[model samples]
Target chain A: MPRTRPNLLERQRRRLVVPFLLPALLLYALFMLYPAFTTFYVALTEWNGVSAPEWVGVDNFTRLTDDSLFSSTITNTIVFTVLGALVLFPGAMFFGYVTQRLPLGRLYRFLILAPVALSVTTAALLWKFLADPNFGAVQKVLRAVGLDSLASVELLGRPNTAMLMVVLATVWHGIGLWMMFFAAAAERVPAELKEAATLDGASSFQVFRHVVWPLMWEVTRTLLILWMIQGLQTFAFIIAMTNGGPLRATEVIGTYLYKVAFASSEFGYAAAIAVVLFAAILVLTLLSQRLTRRESEQY
Target chain B: MNRRSLLRATAVATAVMLSLTACITSSDDGDEPETESSGGGDASGAPAEITGDLEVVSFYPEGSPDFERLSGLAEAFEAQHDGVDVTLTFGGGQDVPQIEARWRADDPPDVNYGFLDVTLPDGGPWVAAGDTMNLQPAMEQPLEGYDGTWEEAILPGVRPLISVGDDIYGAPESVTTLQFFYNEAIFDELGIEVPETFDDLIAAADTIKAAGIAPFTVTGTFLPYMQVYWDYLALRHFGLDGLQQAIAGEAELASLPGAQEAAADLEALVADGNFLDGFRGVDFTSAQMSFFQGDAAMILMGSWLIGEMAAAIPADFQTGTFAFPTVDGGSGDQDGLFGGTNAQVVAAKGQNPDAAEAWLQFIADPANQTAYVESTGGISAYTGIPAPEGFEDVTAMLEEGAAFAPSYMGVLALSQEVQTAYQQPIAQLFFGEIDGATMLTQMSEGLQAAAG
Candidate 1:
């Protein structure tokens, strides 16, 4: 049978979709896409945000290779990303599982997630006071315990410990959210499957390893990507706590980008750093997605 | 309906929407605020009657003494100029960024309170862009209710503090000199006379350390405080011109014999454990607390330290300041002092230039300057203004100094990258993580690269 043409009303409604979408699309283009494309162009120029931008080809990128600070920042970003994943992925999963089996689990979850309610700056400030070498509670406790030598060590001052301290603060603030995510995923696991496995003499650990873990793969993968991105973009807590000090010990890509742009007024160079960071995040995300991709299982 | 009619309707709708969007988002070129003409000139060529809303922005937040004093000044200016309405915007610590955004948006405040140096990028956006009104014209005019020309009324040392080339962009509100602020009680108890030479200073530190108290305390996390020591040492070793040359990339910092000596001296200070325990980790406030609480015997800070720690200072605590000591066999002029100006500028593109100039002139007036000195506990940039009673030592030191050397870190003459290059290494030097030679080498290399 010959298909009838769409009515004028239907055609009008169809046409309205584009116009309706145009406002949001225009906003997205104006705010996000435009700045993103501009950032790429800016990466190749020598703009100080005040004067007109001067095109410098790949000069900024070349400079990046020689920038010791940029190299160190990259190293810092990688370390944070890797360490964050190693800590959060399994740590969140374990806590989620343990809390699921415990009495008054809600209280435990509430306590764990409390830090998430505070702003990164507030949490950082709180931790800074706690870690203060002279009069902080940690130092006080250490001294009280006759560990005066340990108490004397400035945790946030030394290069070896500054970054770690920042990361720990970040984790303390973030682990709750990750745990909640995993808990929700764990809740969705087929209870019948676990019960059947238990009936088959499979231990709780065995059931979790074989049944629960496999089912939670998709959630875990998504969490890993999110954690990786968050880790790469870490800035506020470090800025509040260290401001990339103790000899640039806690300098990360995010802070370095800020310093380059605002402190040094090298917008072009900063743009280059930002572009590299964006690309790094993009590549890692895409690679992780590919590796984590799997055929849908009929459970 | 037929397909052809439907297609036509769709095209019409698309065209209508496009036009509407274009019309809604179009820029209004005609709506730009008209630049008001200069107000009618008085006998002195200054505005006869300053009128209009003058928006003044400051880094001083509300509730602070500086803010209250400035607010009073604004009220006084308003009372004097009947037609003018002075609006003060307090930005806390975000004044620079706020002013920059306003300038970019073409809505800058009539007046801006900020640091004078354009070299330090964070001071204010107007200096680098030449957006501030050239104060030379205003400075030549006699200050209202003052005894001399505005320029003459301003302290000679502070005249050049706010200048770029021959053009002065801002009027200094106060002058701050950096020196060792020691507890007079501690010094008297320890029998450590104010060190006159580098060796004597080191010996004093040794005696203080032997007494089981840190000789010096600094905010190592805040790189600028660490740089203060390094800067004074460099100034003592190489002199102002030599250090300036090094900062300008005309000479390598490490290669300069004076720089090497300064570095070695700094290393010696570190090796002697002069700084507070775990100083590398301590922030400015913590370090300040340590000094005020007597955990540390002395602190190297600006004159503003008194104002900042006014409440924190113990009731019986007597503070005394000494000039950075001379280094034996050093090339630097022994009488040079490290300090800078806290100045205010009028935005060139502001709507109320006439009123802004009037406000600046009023601030420069002796009575207001005196009030600022008293309220802020800072040294006035206006000449003949007496230092506060408790600050006689700093005043005497300032008077005795042969020349004022702008702080190395505060001088934006060197790019921040170059500054950071030395700053981090200086931290290492303090921590004994890197030697003085290594720190100097890094500085020299960084300066060379920055120059290129």
Candidate 2:
């Protein structure tokens, strides 16, 4: 006889796996994959999401070049991304080291991640209250300390200051998650390398600069890529807090896209804006991935 | 691994299936079942007894005290109606796109809030596409108890907004107009008389500035404050109809002499340093509080500010209201009041159109209108309804010279794209970043693009 077929029990077990996996796969396909693909398709059309779409054939893309707001938003996104990378990357690495090495390290780490657990909405509201020009807690404190002008100035009402405040708030709220990641990565660094550096009379700083950083580069590069992508998608903080106001000083690509899509109902224009942001992030992510590969290969 | 385990697995699987089945089945019949009774003896006698569950939607934002009162009213209505239940859904704030989307959906809300500018550029498509009900029949029907407000004394300018070529769409809920709310104490301290003309306003600003207080306070948050400049100047220069004509596309903004003067007048206000430094960053809440804290002497705000101003100030805080200062020698005589009313209309496709109409009739009563006005700090559109308590001083200003001109700018003719486009240019004017003529040019171009 040919190879004996599996028993009914085995056959039934194999069939059981399909049913178990199918629902989750089907849900993912329906909710995530389908919508994402449709969004891509819509991006290429001149549709307002109300009536039937007109085929503009990249006219939206052409229009975006001359649009002052689009260009400004792109600039803001780059600025926000750079600022986040500079602050979050090194700041997290430093904090992770300090928490791991310093006294009361556990308590400090707990405090650091507190904001991370707090919703961005809550954080935005809290900071807005603090930054209020009239009766904010921050203003009151600053006034008591003889910094009356700073207290009186509407921090989020001005242009450059509003942009700065947005970046500062975002960095503060986001640094904790990166710190947590760095701490874990730092902990996983070979104890042998650390001990070897110590035997050679290397100071803590030197040990970190030479051994720890290289080992953690893999993790940092990975995180940097993720943060870069997240940074481009920044919306809630700017929208909830600033609303891209005081003459569009703080309008980011994400917020600009949202205003065009939902507020103005110019879905096609918004899609074009989104495609530009998506392309930028995609390029940055791929470039970072390549850099990470080269760095990993060196070891 | 074994038959015993297999049996347990099937048992668990069957339990999961049963639980899911129960959830799906239960959810499918969430709405209460209505037993239709035919032509029974009812007071409003029509065909079938009105009994059904309704899913209603409106653009009223959640945190308002009015929303809670309305919800309470719905519950009371349900209790009185016996078998009828109403479920309400609220809409987004500061944006109407979400509300419009619901209107265009396959199953729209039973009712919705429509902007007075029903014939917007982008809106034309939807109206043409049949997203909205014609509403002529419902609007023209003499709302039983609403006759007093609906008939005579309704603001003349406001009537046009509710009608399109003689077909009424909605009724008014509240009427608002621009007025100067001033701190009498500050005026007394500075020995400055309240301004009666644009020149006087400029002079008062100088006097107030000399007294070490900001002359004017305007909210930088909402577009209303920025638009007030245009409104005040337009009325003072060419009048409401002149601006209305420009907004209605009857007159080109670039060619209108009144439009030019209005722009120039606003430019003067910015050049005079009447507002606080970087006032563009200062939001409405802050601007409002600034007056209460005695940081500013006067604010150009709507009648709604009368209540808000009273609530924010000290218990004994005294404030006064006056009509916006007229340009003494303007080209046109325009009334300086900006006011309109909101009407509730039933959707044509609504399952319980009659019931919705019934609710509208109930609320249309002056007795109910008074209660709503009291709860919401709004003026009942009904002429017979007396103004609420503590609205005395403001009402006096209204009695003196209140002309009800509905907001007919972006909402009336401009698209959402054009509305947003105006925001930046208008903001720039407030900051002395752009002149009025340039602003008007940009607005005209934006409108033309929308037209295309």
Candidate 3:
């Protein structure tokens, strides 16, 4: 095909591109790309954070085949991400649509978002204290209701209970931000469409399923990807609450790699884990982008 | 855009990333605080006439007594040298990474705490990297504060901690040991004798439990707290050398002599419900709080626990100590001390080696170490110094015939990775989710993988 050369306006625009684009590209490469490439290189070496890095190509990667810990690590990461999506997305969507039509809507919004404002450590610690087996509010409430059996549940010791509490805290701390996105997206879906559907005897559930779902899919996809990325790399909540304990029940890639790097001084192996994490995130993001592809609904 | 313009932009981006990379990573271009020079001449200080700017750094938080003591030492060194200026840097809690970043740039503090397990937390990695100065020559000569050479001044068991081969990397300041700290009121109420052997200890725990109190409490959230349980047991079981060889894979871990009995002893304590409920979830501070609040009768902790928990202790709380109970029929020394030494290290490429050495010499003086022990509420490495007033029990355990051992888990002079692997299975083992044989096998395998 014969290429059409740019005219005066296009040429002038192209001339300004290098100077304007250089700074951002440099920043992106330095902070993002450089570290990423470094991780890939380091993964092939056997380096402690202190000593010189020794090349041990594919050794760190191959260890995943037999590393029982990595299997649990993957399961834990997926549970957090998948469970978080189930709770956060639906809850956010419900609240997003409900609050604007309710009295004291602004107050409700503020209250839900309050957990988000607090630091991650603060929020996790609050949850930990509440779930503390002895004298915590969770046990106190269970006992107050006279359900003694449930009161005996050790919130953090058992594998399932520990992960359950962590996920609950994560959802409580996270949903508010997504709710804001949903509320905004819901607002953009013209009221007349819901009203017409209601007048035609469609149920609220049907209206939401058919109308709101399509309009909000774009935002939802992005949120899901963000949740996946955040979930796979969860470190703070596990470290702060359980420290990957009850015998590695809640270990995730982020926490595991941190232990390998700082605790074991196996920086090279840590870097390898980091590389795999990066690849997983990239694949999931791309897959989500592809699966969510659709024609834009022009409201 | 034309192809040439697009190519040009890519080249520009690459150049920017390349050219500014060094500038971004550089640790210093005059970021260090200007040296607060005392102008050493004619000042009333030591006779040393060293002339240079020295940087001394510590990882202690500002306003901590440790940091204050260090600054005081730095001030004294400045006064003594007359010609040298010393800058003391406090890392607040982020000191290790901050110091390492500097070292990566080939610039580290002139003198620093090595972060030894016995002497300082987070100590070995720097020494393993060969970043610290070797103190052998200095150890050979007489230091003014002690009657003997520097090496002789330090208690015998401590030197091996910071040593790599024949070269010693850190200067020992003080040491500590582990003993049972009992709530005297509780013991008196329950009529429990101070436990002298494993049987007596078990009986004491049973008595305490019968009285509706948790007999013992430990930080389940912190692995080292649980892992420390194995230290005395394994020490008494395999004895010191055997346990060491077992951990190092020189001896068969499974066939170690006292293994079965010690394992039963450990599992029985938990199975009998002798610990606080939900102990595994309780953190260090929480466990200590439980002990302090008198919810638990006793806590197995280090000698430093007193100083660490000083602020939290109640005014009328009567705390008493006894050596960790000896295991009957064990091959190890019955009165072996369970503790480690703490030390300060010098950077290999410090600006003024002589001044750094002089500063350390001043620190090593029996007077300063004595002061450290007094203010820090711990035992000094300097031999002649008397044990701090309340630490007579710890000192008595340090008697000539008594054996000394660092914590098997916490300050074991092993990599944290290997230590963590050994500790991770303890929760399962303690919860009775895994048996003794399984635990030992898992631990050996874990150690191999960690070491690999």
Model 3 residue B83 CA deviation (Å) reads 10
Task: List the candidate numbers ranked by DockQ, top first.
Answer: 1, 3, 2
Give candidate 1 regions above 4 Å deviation.
A1-11, A297-299, B1-52, B62-65, B75-95, B114-129, B389-403, B410-416
lDDT of 2 by residue, B15-74 (tens): 655555464346323342232333342223233355776655644546555566678878
lDDT of 3 by residue, A48-164 (tens): 666668999999899866676777789889987898788888999999988877899878988898889989999888988888767479988999999889887777877778888
lDDT by residue (B28-121, candidate 1, tens digit) is 3344444443456432545566777888886677877667777888889889988788888874452465666676556778888652455544
**Native-referenced DockQ of model 1:** 0.42
Expressed as tens digits, the lDDT of each residue in B1-452 for candidate 3 is 56876897677767776676666556444454332233332212334457878887765666766677788988887777676778878743324657766775667777776533323334456665556767777777676767777777776656666666676667866676776789999999888889999989889998998899999988766767777677777777667776666666566666777876667667766677788877876677778888988999998887777666767889899888887788888876576667766567766656665667677778878778778777767787667788875567555545342436766534334554466567776677876688766777777677666656
lDDT scores of the candidates, listed in order: 0.79, 0.68, 0.75
Who is ahead in TM-score, 1 or 3?
1
Model 2's CAPRI class is acceptable
Poorly placed runs, candidate 3 (over 4 Å): A135-137, A140-148, B1-95, B109-111, B115-125, B141-144, B349-376, B396-403, B409-421, B444-452
Best by lDDT: 1
Q: Candidate 1 chain B, which ten residues in sequence have the lowest lDDT sum? A: B27-36
lDDT score for residue A6 of model 2:
72
Residues A50-165, model 2: lDDT tens digits: 56778877888888887767788888888878876877788889999889988999899999888988899889877876787765787789889999887767788777678778
**lDDT tens readout by residue for model 1, A129-197:** 888887689889999999999989899998888888888888888899999999999999989999999
